[model samples]
Target: MKNLERFLSEHQQLTRRHFMRLGAAGAAALGLWPLTADAAPAAPELSKAIETLEPYFTPREKFRDVSRGKPLPHSLPDEKKRAVGLTRETWKLEVISDPDNPATLRSPLTQKDGTALDFDGLMKLAEKHAVRFPKVMTCLNIGCPLGMGIWEGVPLREVIWLTQPRENLRRVFYHGYHNDDPQQMFRSSLPISRVLEDPFDLPPVILCYKLNGQWLDSERGGPVRVVVPEAYGFKSIKWLTQVVLTNLYHANDTYAEGNNDIDSWLKTFAATISVPREVKPGEPMPVTGYAQVGLAGLSKVQVWIQSNAVERPTGDPHFTTAPWTDAEILAPPKHWGALPDGKIPANTLGFDDATGQPRTWPMRLAKVHWAALLPGLPAGEYTLRCRTIDEKGNAQPMPRPFQKSGNAAIESVDLTVKS
Candidate 1:
C-alpha cells in the first residue's frame, strides 16, 4: 500500500479523466455497483481499482504479430551474411574465456579447462530451465523497424551461473558472428550486476532460440540472440555466438559511437493518431490510434484540435507554439484482440451503476486502442493532435526539432474540413 501511494505521488500526472475509470473498475472487482464521477470514490476505492488493473500494466505473454503485417527484412551486412551450408542445425554458440583478459584461458563451460560446449550441449542446458515472455523491440534510430514477439529461451543469468564467473567480474560482453574483421564486428556489454541481479519487476535477460512459437530465423537474429527488454534494439545483439565475462566495459555499440544516445530511457508515451486525410464539413470525423510506453505504463491519451497558434510553456524547443482545444476522451475496446477458443475477453471498461453505461477506458496498458468522434466542423484547415501521459505524469515528446534519442512527440494530422 505504501508502495502504491509512493508510485502515485511520484507520478501525479495521472489526469482526472482516468480517475472515474479506475474507480469504477475497483467497484466492479468487489462485486459492488460501479461508482459515478459525481459520487467521488475514496482513495481506498481507487487503490483497489489499481490493483485489479495490474495485469494489463505489464507486457503481454502471448505474442501478437505487430510487424505491421509484413515479412521480416533480410538485410544483414554482406560480411555477416550466412554461408550456404550454415543453418540453425549447424550453428554453435561459443562460451569462451574473456578476450579482454590475456591471462584467462578459453572456454568457460568445459571441465577439461580449455574446450567449449557445442550447440547440442547448450540446448540440453537450456531445455532444463527455459523461460518465455513477450517483448517489444524498437530501434534507437527514429524510423527503424519495430517488432513484438514471444521469446523462448534460458535466462542469461542461468547460463552465467553454469560458467561460474569469478567474483571480481565487472562486465559481460557478447557478440554475434560478424566477419573475422574486428572493425566490422558489432558487440555490446552489460554491467555484470545487470546480468546477475534479477529484478522482480523487469523481464529477465534471455538468450532466445524461438520467437513467436517458431525457431528464430536468421533474418531476425537467429539460431541464438540476446533479448534485452529494458534497452533499445542495439542492446539486443543479433546472430549471437559468444559470451565473455570481463572486468571492463566495452563501448562497441555502432549506434552509440556517433549521433545516437545509447543510454536514453525507452520512450514510454508515444502515440499515433489515425485519421482520414480529408473530411467534409458537418460530417463525423472518426479518429482511432494506438499508444505505447515503456514499463511505466500509459495513463491516458488526450486529443486536441486547434486552428490558431499558441505559446508553449514546457520549455521543450519542439513545443514553441501551443493553444489546443480539448476533444472527447475515447473508450478502450472490450478486448485487446480476438481471443482464441476457450479464452475469455478482458473487459477494459467499467459500467455505470445506475444506467449500466460504460464510464471510462482502461488506460494502464502497454498498448491501448483509443477512438473519438469529431462532429460538425466548419470548412477550414485544422490540425488534429494527440498526446499520451504515462502513469508518472510525463507527457509525450513534442515533434519539431528532431531528437535523435528522446520520447516521440505527440502525433498530429492536418486535415481540410471540406465544404
Candidate 2:
C-alpha cells in the first residue's frame, strides 16, 4: 500500500509517455515486475527513415590527447592543482608586456593596479564579445586532424586592448600550465597584427574556454587555451596561463626548434575511411573519406581508380596528371548530434546569425567528409586514391610539394573485385 501511494505521487508528474516508461521501474521498486520481459509492448518507429550524419563535435574524451609535459598534470592524481591549477573557480589570467618596456596602455597595467583578470572577470567580459566557431585542428607533421570542435571565447584582441598594447610590440606569445621544468615549457606566438585585428576574414585569435558547450577540462587544455584558426594546431597553445607582449620581430614558436615550419598553414588534403578489400562483381562499391578544407578553401573532393595491371610510366610520384573524377561532399547534416540540441549556435563566426548556416558551403579551416560510388568490376585487383581540389584551382600537393610546411600527400586504398 505504501509503495502504491509513493508511486501514485511520482506518477502524476510524469508525462503519459514517460508514465509508461517508468511504470516498469516502479513495479521493480515494489518487487512486482517481471525479471526479464518488458512491462508493455514496444512503441512504433518514430521516423520512416534515418539519415547518416558525420559527427559535428568530437566528444571531449574522444579528442586526441596530445598534451605535452614531462609528466602531464592531468595524469598526475594529486598534483594537478600545483601543476595546472584545475577548476573554474580557481582560474586566473594575466596579459602583460615585456617587464622592461611596461607596454603602451590606457589603463596602467601594474599588478598593483588590479589589472590581472580572474575567471569571473573573463566571464563578465564575454557577455558582449564572446564568439564561437568550428575548426578542425590538424598538426603540421601528422597527416590527420586531431579533432574538430565548437570553440567559444573572447578574442585575444579584446583581452590585449584591456592592457592597451601597441604595434611597437612585434609579437604576442602564450603558454599553458606545465611541469615546473623550464625545458618542458611549451610556447607559441602570433604576429601582433594577427591578434590585434582581423584580416582576410581569418577567425580572430581567441582565448577560449568552452568546448562543445561544456567548461573545458584540464585534459582538454582548459580553463583556457589560445585558438588560432588560420594556423596549425601548434599555434594554439593549451592550458593557457599567460599572455605576453614582446618586441621581438621574428616568430619565436617553440615548435620551430623541432625543425618544423613555424608558419605552415594547414593544407587541403584527403584520406580514406574504411574501404573493402574484396567485393563481388556487379555491386556498387562505396568509397568514403574526409577532406580538410585549408586556408585556400575546398572546391571538391576528387578520386581516381586504376587496376593494378596498368603499369605507371615512372617519374610522377605526386600523381600530377592522374585521371581523377569528382566525389560528392556530404551535405550539411539534417540533425547535428554533436551540437547542443541539434541546433547550430547563431553566434558561430562566419555563420548566418538568422539561419545559423555557414556563409560558405564547405567552411574553410575545417574538415568535410566525402564519398564516391564505383561501378562493378570483374575479378581483378585495383587501387583507389582521393585528393581535394582547393578554391584556387590547385589539387592536392599542387602549389606545395610538401617539403616541411605541412604534410600534403594523397591517400589511397586497395580493393579487389572478386568474380
Candidate 3:
C-alpha cells in the first residue's frame, strides 16, 4: 500500500498537466458528548484489540454516533420525519438565498422552474459528479475520533456552480433537518472561495450521501449530509436540507454561541488505542494508536515510557527532552472490509481507479494508525505517553496548544508491569 501510495503521488505529479483536481468541536456547550479515553463509547466493532495495524475503513454502522441533534435526524420516528418533511420520498433541498436578506444569487439551482431538490434529483446529480475518499470524522474538543469512512459525495462547487452563481455571494452556509426550530439548526458556513476553489489544495467540500460505498442508513445521515474534510465535525451538518449562498462574510456556525474560536482550524493530535496494563521483564509489550493529520500535516508518531518509580523530569511536562521512540505507521489495510464485495468502488478520489489503491500513505486530513513494541521493563508501573510529530517537525501540542481551537494535549496512560 505504501508503494502504491508513492506510485500514486509520483503518478499525479507526472500527470499534473493532464489532470487537475481537486479536492470543530465543541461538545457540552452545544450538547455534544465528546469522546475521550475515559469517556470511550461502547462501540464494540470499533474497539480494536489488535495491537498491530488498525483497520483502514470503519463499518458504517460501527462508526461512533456523536450526533448533536436532540432527537438525531436518523433517530426520529417515521411520523416525526414526515412532520418535518425529511422523509426520503418527500425530502426537498432548497438551494436559495436567505429569504430575509436575499443575496444576488437567488434560487440558483432548482428542479423544474423553482422547486427544491428531491432525493431522486440528488441521486441523478450523483450519477454525474460523485467522488470518494477516506476521511477521519473527529470532534474539536475531544482527544479521540468518532471514526473513519470512505465518504462519497458530489463536490459542493459542482452543485453550486451549475447555474453560475451571480454576484454578492460571499459565503455558502448550510444546515440539516433540525425539527423546524431555529435554535436547533446545526448550521455552518464556508467562504465562497473555500467552496469554489481549492486554494490550499485541500479536500473539496462535498455534499455527502454515502459512506464506505453504501447508502447512508438514516443513523449515518442518510439521504444527504455535508462532509467537510478540513474542518471539525460541526461543519459537516447531517440530514441536510438547505444550502444558502449568502453575502454574509462571517461564518454562521451554530457552535458560535458559547464556543471559543469558532473559526479555528483543527489541530493535530494523537490517541492511544491499546496498551496492556501488565507485561513481564523479557516480554515485548505491544502499543498502538492513531495520529490525526491536521492542516499542519503529520511527520511521525512517537512514544515515551518510563518507570513510575523513577523520578520524572520535573521541568519537561511536554517531554521535549524525553526518550521517545518512533512507531511504525501501518500501511493501508489489505482488505477494507467496508464495501460489500470487499472491493473499493471504482474511481475513489485520491485512489488509482485501476488497482483500487490510495495514492499516498498518511493522507493529510486523515488518520495514520501506528504501532510499536516496547522492550522488557524490569518492574513497576510505567508512565506511557504517545504523540505525533507534525510535518513542521513540531511535537504534539507544541505548535497548537489547546485553546478556544481544539485539544492537542499529550495523551498518556499508566501501564503496570507485574513484578
Off by over 4 Å in 1: 1-86, 102-115, 143-145, 308-366, 398-402
- lDDT for model 1 comes to 0.54
Displacement of the residue 80 alpha carbon in candidate 3, Å: 3.1
lDDT value for candidate 2? 0.71
TM-score of 2: 0.83
Candidate 2 per-residue C-alpha lDDT over 359-390 given as tens digits, one digit per residue, 9 for 90 to 100: 88688888876554555565667788888889
**Per-residue CA lDDT of candidate 1, range 1-419, in tens?**
45533432332233234333334434444333444555434344233423333222122333222221012223444333445112555555556556556214323764345344455655787767676554556666543225544567777887777665555577777887665556656777777677877554565688888765567766667777898767777788877777877756555456667677766645655444457667777665555555655656667666656442322366654342443222222333232222232112122122344543334333221344444444435566767777766667665663222466754756668878776
Supply candidate 1's per-residue lDDT for 419: 65
C-alpha positional error of residue 73 in candidate 2 after TM-score superposition, expressed in Å:
2.6
Decide which is better by lDDT, 1 or 3: 3
lDDT of 3 by residue, 175-273 (tens): 888867787887888888888877676768888878887777678776788888788888888888889888876888877865756667767778787
Give the Å error, residue 252, model 3.
Answer: 1.4
Per-candidate TM-scores read: 0.68, 0.83, 0.83
